[model samples]
Target: MGAAEWMQARSPEQSLTARIVRWYSFLSATLVGG
Candidate 1:
């Protein structure tokens, strides 16, 4: 149960990190292209 709760809490953080990474990559590509 504790492990499940920890995993649930971690999943959002991982998702947010992935989103931030994707956004950063997009911005970098746009800047480089322009």
Candidate 2:
């Protein structure tokens, strides 16, 4: 399956870790950017 399909296949609970990692990266980027 493609990325979109894979993402759609994932449940929110299963994707929580991914979401946290993404959020962490986003926060770190903002801090570093600023």
Candidate 3:
């Protein structure tokens, strides 16, 4: 999905854990690429 669409799709009620998981995965991918 487009960045804007994804940002808009994120609900305020979404759990913090979900965001943490996404952040972890993103960080892992960046580390692996580097």
Question: TM-scores of all models?
Answer: 0.54, 0.54, 0.56
Candidate 1 lDDT over 1-34, as tens digits, reads 5744554476766766666676688889999999
Instruction: For candidate 3, write residues 1-34 as lDDT tens digits.
Output: 4643463369446546566677688889999999
Q: Between the candidate structures 2 and 3, which one is better when assessed by TM-score?
A: 3
Error of 2 at 27 (Å): 0.1
Model 2 regions lying over 4 Å from their true place: 1-14
Candidate 2 overall lDDT versus native: 0.67
Could you arrange the candidates by lDDT from highest to lowest? 1, 2, 3
> TM-score of the candidate numbered 1?
0.54
Model 2 lDDT at residue 3: 46
Residues 1-34, candidate 2: write the lDDT tens digits. Answer: 4643454467556576676676688889999999
Superior candidate under lDDT, 2 versus 3:
2
RMSD of 1: 9.6
lDDT of 3 at 2: 67
Candidate 3 minimal-lDDT segment of 10 residues: 3-12
Model 1 residue 14 lDDT?
A: 73
lDDT of candidate 1 vs native? 0.68
